[model samples]
Every structure is written in structure tokens, then in C-alpha cells.
Target chain A: MELFQEVILRTGFLALTWGQLVMWAVGFTLIYLAIRKGFEPLLLLPIGFGILLANIPLTPLMTPGSGLIWRFYHYGLEWEVIPPLIFLGLGAMTDFGPMIANPKTLLLGAAAQVGVYFTFFLALLLKFTVPQAAVIGIIGGADGPTTIYLASKLAPEMMGVCAVAAYSYMAMVPLIQPPVMKLLTTEAERKIVMKSLRPVSKLEKIFFPVVALFVICLIVPDAAPLMAMFMMGNLFRESGVVARLSNAAQNELMNIVTIFLGVSVGATMPAATVLQPKVIFVFILGCAAFMLATATGVLFAKFMNLFLKEKINPLIGAAGVSAVPMAARVVAKLGSEANRKNYLLMHAMGPNVAGVIGTAVAAGMFISVLAK
Target chain B: MVNLESPLSGKILEINMEVGQQVNEDDEVIIIEALKMENPVYCPATGVVKEIKVRIGDQVNEGDILAVIE
Candidate 1:
């Protein structure tokens, strides 16, 4: 009878705690949402499964050498291979034509970084260490891989919470952007019609990636790995001779990295690490950082209008965060809400792409200051 | 070298310039599309549109001549 009790006690069913059950439910919920609602399913689905695999009591999945999931985490994530590969795919898929057409948008992209730094200081006031705060604040930029890449390097312990915050905020771009956008501007400001974009030449389009690599890398060498891979991918797309490579990067490369990255990232969340007071602070600071980025973009656009004879629709300013299509779509939707005829999607894309490059450069700057 | 302008490799949705139109620099002459983004091919130099090589709904390749400027 005593031996039978010992065997029962050792079994996973008997060993499961209430907290573990709750965590399992939460993980399942995330998976459900990702599948049913399409909430970043590309990343979230794998992440949810990883979380489920990690949380089950008595599972050997993360047990040092014996765990399959744990082995994946160690190989792809700890070695810092997955994020850079994601950057390579992103580089291949991005179009620099809009940035080339209006090179001045680069300044708007640069100006948007003010929000990230400003939030960094705010995180410091809330008692986070400068490095930890810097990583947390960059979540506001709404660039998920960049956030994961930075947090993994600087404060690996904070990786799960920081990534969750970054992606959650990125997915919430439509929600978080508009209220701040409405508060900062009036009906007339939202309705402001901008001139159509000037035609960008194919030669100029081809020249942009090369020039960007030179100028941005020369200015911020620490960001070279991410920036160089991104620009090289863009070059592949623009070069007109690499259709097969470009398609592979956009589809195959993106899908593979996303699975590995999502799983490894989810596995890092070990409950104890993510349930801390500091983790809560990370989420709050992330919101402030994003709000500040959108505000800075809008304010800068308003300021630029003072210098130009022709005006730009300030709605495009909100797209200065690196959320890509989501941010650009938000800008267009807001414009249409204010005026029926406003079609600003293409116009907003110019600043949206600029925002991506700008945020990468800022990440390089942060690594230079904090990592070393 | 004779400068030739055409839509990038994609579907040409609309042709806005004719063979004899006096095309100026920056005028939208042809529309090519990919990834749901419609990109306009513009006149690179101020001149007469000597040829209209592609019609509506024709597919084009990068550097293919949609028009000639001289």
C-alpha cells in the first residue's frame, strides 16, 4: 500500500498544482484566440503551444538535455540565431521606394525615437535599471523582433515579459493609436489633404538600399548586423534579378524563423519570471513608450508643416512607429473616418517604412550605449 | 544610350499616356501593380511619348519599354 502511494505521488496528475492548471488554461486561451481570431497567429500559435508544453507538470520537455522543447530554446534562442534570421527575411520583404521618394521622411523616422528615449527615462523613475528600462521602453516602438533581440542580449531574464509586451502592443496598434491621435488633433487636422507622392525612379529605388547601408552603418556600427541583413534583403527585392531568393525570404524564411522564435520565446516565460512586479512595470512602460512614439510622430509632422508651402496630412505621422501595415492602415482608416474621399494608404506607407529603418537604427544606438 | 521607361515587373492595370502625348518629367504614364500596391511609372525626362508599347491589362517586366521618350 505504501509503494502504491509513492507511485501515485510521482505521477504528473497527482503532482499538478492549481497554479499550473491556471497557467495551462491561460496558454490554451492564447492558442484559441490566435487560431479563431487571427491575433498574430503566425507567432502566437507556436508560442502558445510552447507555453503549454513547458507548463505541464512533470514533463521532461525542458529538463536540461532530455527536453525536446528546451533543446530548441537553447539552440535557436540562446545562441541568438533566430532573431537575425528573422531580420534577414524582413530585409528581403521590405520596400524602400517610399523612403527614397521622400528622403525627408527619414528625419521624421529619426524624430520618432525621442519617444523611446523619453520613456527610457520614465522607466528609470519607476525604479528599473537603466539597461532594463531601455529594453522595456523600446517595446513602444512596436517592433517585436527588435524588442526580443535587444532583451535577449541585455536582460535575458526579462525576455518573455518584454516580448509579450511588445507583440501585445503591436497587435493593439489600431486600439492604442486612435485615441491618442484624436486627442492630439481636431477634425480639420485629420482631414488635411496632402499632395500625391512624386514618381520615384527605378534607379533611385535601387540606389536607396546601398546608400542606406553605407550611411546608417557608418553612423551606427553596432546596429550593422540587423540593419545590414534588412537592407540586403531589400536589395534582393529591388535588384530585379533575384525573384526566387526574394520569394524564399518572404515566404519560407519568414515562416520558419517565426515558428522557432515564437516557440523559444514562449518557453522562456517560466511563470515565476513573468509574474513579478517588475514585469507589470514593463507592460505599463511599454504603453507609455508607444503612446509617446505616436505623439512625437504627429507633433513632428505638425511642426514640419510650418516650413513647407504644401502641407502633409498629419495622420501619416501616427504611422512613424514600426508596426508596418497595421500602423499604416490605422492612419488610412482615421483619414477616411474624417473624410470619405481620403485615401492615404500609399501615402502613409512612406512614413511606415521609414519608421522601421528608424527603429532599427535606434536599437543600434541603444546597444552601443547600454550593451557595452 | 536611348532612355526607355516601363513599369516594373508586374501587371499593368492602366495606361495613362499615349504615343503622341507631350509627357513632362514626373507625369504618371503607366500603372504597374504587385502585392496589392499599385506603382505608377513616370516620365523620367521631358519629351514627347514616342511609343506606347503596353496596353491596359498587359503584364510588364522590369526595364521593359512601356514608352520611349526623346
Candidate 2:
């Protein structure tokens, strides 16, 4: 009878708290979103499964030194290895042709980063510490890996929530951006058809990554690690000689790192850490950041049009959120809705690609200013 | 002999020309799909399509000979 009582007392069901049960539900919701809604399945799926594993009572999966997920989190995330590798793959896959074709769109990309600064101040007003606010503000850039990198460095405790907020907002770009974009722009602006981009020469393509690295990194030495790796991967693709290496970087390397990154990030979100009123506020601020970034991009383009001889489609400005192809596609869809004959995909890609670099630079600035 | 090569690596989606066909400069000779975008491979010089070296769905690398122009 004593043995039976001991066994019952030791079982997980007896020890599990309501907070853990709520976290499990959140995990399952992430799984459902990944599978059914197709929202960043590669990332969200592993993260969801990791959440379930981490929440299991007395599993020790998230405990220091003993758990596999914990090891992944500590070594991969805490050491800051995964996000930069993800940037490597991102660089390998990105084509800067559109951005090279229209150098002016780089300004739009810079303009969109206004959200990061704006959110930083807002988070401070909401009573977050300077470091926490800096970490939270990066959620506006809509670049998941960069956000994770900055948060892990400056505010380790906020890493999981900030990553989730950045990624969820990125996935929600199609929904969040369109409403803000529509509200900010007139039909005439949306319907503005951009002229076809000039074809970039092969030599120019080969030179861009190198020249960009030298100039940008020289200016912001803090951004060198991410920027150097990013530009190196791009040079591999553009140089056309290291195809095998580029392929590995984009496919095998990226997939393995993503699995580690997603699971580790999810493991960080145990019930005790994640189920806070602060998280909800972070999400609210994150959405505001995205909206502000989008609005700033559009408005900047409109402002620039006043000085330029050839006007740009202000809609392309909204693509400057570093959500990669999704933000650009949203701009294209909105443009087409205004004018069916208008093709804005390639044009938007210029700013879309530029946004990735812009976000990295912004993250670097935050890290240098705050973390140092 | 003038060699017409693919400017980018991709799968040959469609071959738009045949051997012995007269081609003009800037005329698309083949459509190559790379990075999910279909790029039209235009004839760089006005010439006769002497031979087609690639077929539909063949994976090509940058600067691979797609056709030989005479």
C-alpha cells in the first residue's frame, strides 16, 4: 500500500500546474498553425514539438547540462551560432539583382527601420529596461533570426518571446501589411507602374557583395559578423564558381541549423518564463512596430517622389520590412488590385532584398549601442 | 561557330527554337527556369541555330552551352 501511494505521488499528473497545461495548449496551437495554416511549418513545427517536450513534468529536457533540448538551447542559441548560420543560408539564396538595378530603393529599406526605433521608445514608455526595449524593438524589422540574435545578446530572458513575436509578425505580413498599406496610400499611388529595371551586368553582380561588405562593415564594425557571412554567401552565389558550396549553404546547412534553432528557441519558453502579461504586451508592441515600419516605408517613398524626376510606385516602399519575398508579394498583390496590368513584383523585390540588409544593420546598431 | 550559353543555372523549361532556324539578335531561343523565375535566353547575336545542345527539363549551370550558333 505504501509503494502504490509512493508511485501515485511521484507521477507527473499530480505535479503539473495550470501554467504548464496552458503552455501545452499553446504548443499544440503552434503545431496546428504550422500544419493546417501552413505558417512557417519548417520552424513552427519543431518549436511546437519542443514546447511539448519542455513542458513535460520533470522531463529535465530544459534543465541545464542534462537535457538534449537544453544543450541545443545553450550551445546553439546561447552561444549565438544558429542565427548567423541562418543568415548565411539567407545570403546564399538571395538575389540582389533587383536592388542592384534600382539603388534608390535602399533608402526605402532604411526608412522602414523607423519601426525599430519607434518601438524601442514605446517599450521604454511601457516600462521595459533599455536592453529589453532594444531587444523588443527589433521585432519591428520582421527578421526572425536577427531579432533572436540581438535578444540573446542583450536580453537573454526575453529571447523566446521576441523570436516568436518577430516570426509570427513575419508570417502575418500578408494580413498586417495590406491593411496598413491600404490605409496609408491612395489608389493612384498603388496603381503607379514602375519602369522595368535595368539588367544588371555579370561583373556588377560579382562585385556588389564584396563592395557592399567593405563599405557597410567599415561603417558599422559591429555588424561585421552577420554582414560578412551574409556577403560571403552571396558572393559564392554570384561568383558562379562555388555552386556546390552555395547549394550546401542554402539547403543542407540551412535545414540542420533551422531545426536546432527552432527547437532551442521553443525550449526557452517554459510556462514559468513565457506565460507572463509581459509577453502579451510584447506581441502588441510587435504589431505596432510592423505597422509603423510599413507606414514609414510607404511615406518615405512618397516623400522621395517629390524630389525625383521619375516617380516610383509608393507601394513598393511597403516591401521594406525584411520579411523577404512575402512583403514584396503583398505589395505586388496590392498594386495589381489597383491596376491589373501593373507588375510590381520585381520592383518591390529591390526594397524587399534591401530590407534584409537594413534590418541587419539596425540590429547591429542596437547591439553596439546597448549590449556593449 | 558562335556558342550560346545559359546566363544562369536552371532547368530548361522550353526550347523555343529548332536547328536550321534563323534567329535574330535579342530573340529568345529558350526559356530557362531559375530560382522559380522563367528567364528567356535570348540569342546574343543574329545567327542560324546550328545545333541545340540541351533538351527540355535538363538542368544547366551558368555559362553551359545551350546551343551552337553558326
Candidate 3:
């Protein structure tokens, strides 16, 4: 009888707390979103599973030194390994042609950073420390790897929340951005049809990554790790002689690092750590950051139209939040809805890709200014 | 002889011209949807559309053969 009672005690039925149950629901919700709703399946799936693993009673998955996930978090994130490697994969897949074709769109990308800076002050007002606020503010940039990179450096405690906020907001771009874009611009501005992008030459494409690498690294050395890897991957693609290497970076290396990044991030949040008022504040601030960023981009584009003879569509400005093709697609959709014949995809892509660099630079600046 | 290939990667949104229909340079023969915008693919040369190998909603990669003309 005593043996049976001891076994029952070890089974976790009575030991499972209400907090862990809530965390399991959170994990399953992510899984459901990934599977049923098709929301970032590659990322959310692993993250959801990792969350489940984290909450299991008596499990050592997140135990200080011996747990499997702890090792991954320690070496991969704390040591500053996985996020930059993911950026390497992203670089290989990215095509700089559209951004190169319309260099002025880079301004829209820079303008979007206004949201990040704005959020920094807001987080500070909420009593988050300087480093914590900087990491939280980066959620506005809407770049996953960059957010994780900064979080791991400035405030490791917030890594999971910041990553979740960044990615979820990114997936919700279609829903979140349209309302803001519509509220900011008129029918005429949205209907404006951008001219087809000029064909970017092979030589120009080749020179872009090199010049950007040199200039950005020289100015913001703190960003060198992520920026260097990103540019090197781009150069590999543009060089045309490293097709095998580029393919591997884009497909294999990207896939591997993504798995680690998702799980490690998810594992950081046990029910105990994340079930707080602070988490809700992070999520709310994240949405605000996105809104501020989107508005800034669109407004900046409108401001630019005041000078140029050829008026660029202000809608493309919202693509500067660095969600890659997703933000650009939302811009294209809005433009199409406004004018059936308008094709703004390529134009939006200019700011879309530039936003990637813009976000990385913003992260670097935060790291330089805030991180001790 | 000429083959009309996809100039960009995207889903086929519409096939504007039927096979055996006459087409000219710059004629919008196919529309591809990418980045949430529909981009028309023009006929590369003036000729009767000899064959159409893609349908609306067919995902295609750049340089994939969509049609042929002679």
C-alpha cells in the first residue's frame, strides 16, 4: 500500500498546479494556431511543443545545468549563436533587386525605426530597466531574429515574451496593418500606381551587399556579427559561383537554426515565469510598437511626396517593419484593393527588404547605447 | 519558335488568352499573383498561342515554361 501511494505521488496528478495547466493551454493554443490556422507553422509548432515540455512536472528540460533545453539556451542563445546563423540563412534567400531598383525606399525603412525608439520610452515609463526597455522596444521593428538577438543580450528573462510578441505581430500583419494604413492614407494615395521597377543589373546587385556590409559595419560595429553574416550570405547568392553554398545556407542551415531558435525561446517561458501582468504589458506594447512603426512609415512616405515630382505610393511605407515579404504583401494587397490595375508588389518589396537592414541597424544601436 | 516562360515566381491568377488565339508583343496573355499583386505576363512575340501549360491558381517558378508559340 505504501509503494502504491508513493507511485501515485510521483505521477504528477496531484502535484500539477493550476499554473501549469494554464501554460499547457497556452502551448496548445500556439500549436492549434500553427496547425489549423496556418500561422507560422515552422516556428509556432516547435515553440508550442517546447512550451509543453517546459511545464511538465518534475521534468528536467529546463533544469539549471542538466536539462537538454537548458544547454541549448545556454550555448545557442546566451553565447550568441543561433539567431545570427538564422540571419545567415535569411540573407541567402533574400533578393536585393527591388531595394536596389528603388534606393529611395531605404528612407521608408529608416523611418519605420521611429516606432522602436518610441516604444523604448514607453517601456521605460512602465518601469522596465533600460536594457529591458530596449529589447521590448525592438518588438516594433517586427524582425524575429533581431528581437531575439537583442533580448538574449539585454534581458534574457524577456526573450520568450519578446520573441512571441514579435512573431505573432508579424503573422498578424495582414490584419493589423490594413486598419492603420487605411486610417492614415486616402483613396487617392492608395490608388496611386507605382511604375514598374527598373531592371537591376547583375553588376549592381553584386556591388550592393559589399558596399552595405562595409558602410553599415563601419558605422555600427555592434551590429557586425548579424550584419556580417547577413551580407556574406547575400554575397554568396549574388556571386553566382557559390550556388551549392547558397542553397545549403537557405535550405539546410536555415531549417536547422530555426528549429533551435523556436524551441529554445519557447522553453524560456515556464508557467511560473510568464503568467504575470508583465507579460500582458509586453504584448500590448508590442502591438503598439507595430502600429507606431506602420504609421511612421506611411506618414514619412507622404511627407516625401511633398517634394518629388514622381509621387510614390504612401502605402509601400508600411512594409518597412521588416516582416520580410509578408509586410510587403499586405501593402500590395491594399494597393490592389484600392486600384484593381495597380501592381505595387515590387515597389513594396523595395522597402520590405530594406526594412530588414533597418531593423538590424536599430538593434545594433540599442545594443551599443544600452548594453553594458 | 518561342516559349513564354514565367518572368517571376508566383501563382497563376489568370490566363488572358486562349490557346490558338492570336497575340502580339506586349499583349497580356497571363497574369501572375505574387506579393499580393497580380502581374500580367506579356506575350514575348507576335504569334498564335500554340499551347498553354498553366492554369489559374497554378504556382510557377521563374523560367518555368507557361506556353509556347511559333
TM-score for chain B of each model, two decimals: 0.83, 0.94, 0.95
By the DockQ metric, which is better: model 1 or model 2? 2
Whole-model lDDT, candidate 3? 0.90
Angstrom error of the Cα, residue B42, model 3: value is 10
**Which segments of candidate 2 are over 4 A away from where they belong?**
B1-70
DockQ of 2: 0.06
TM-score for each predicted model, relative to the true structure: 0.83, 0.86, 0.89
Q: Residue by residue across A214-278, what tens digits does model 3's lDDT show? A: 99999998999899999999999999999999999999999998888889999998988899988
Q: A1-372, model 2: which lDDT tens digit per residue?
A: 999999998889988989999999989999999999999899888888888887889777888988889999989988989988988999999999989989999999999999889999999999999999988888988999999999888998898888888888888998999998998889988888787677789999899999999998888888887898899999989999999999999999999999999998888888999988888999999999999999999999999999988999999999999998889878877887897556577788899989999999998898888876
Q: Return the top candidate by lDDT.
A: 3
lDDT tens readout by residue for model 1, A1-372:
999999998889977766666667767877997899888888778887877776778878889877887777778777777777777788787877666767667767766778998999999999998788879878878998888878877888877778878888888998999998888888998898666566677788778888888999999998887888888888888888998988888889889888888888888776655656677788888999999999999889889989978788887888889988788888877987897446566667778888888888888888898896
TM-score of 3: 0.89
- List of clashing residue pairs for candidate 2: none
From the highest TM-score down, the ranking of the candidates is 3, 2, 1
Best by DockQ: 3
- Model 1 TM-score relative to the real fold: 0.83
Instruction: List ranges where model 1 is wrong by over 4 Å.
Output: A1-3, B1-70
- lDDT winner between candidates 1 and 3: 3
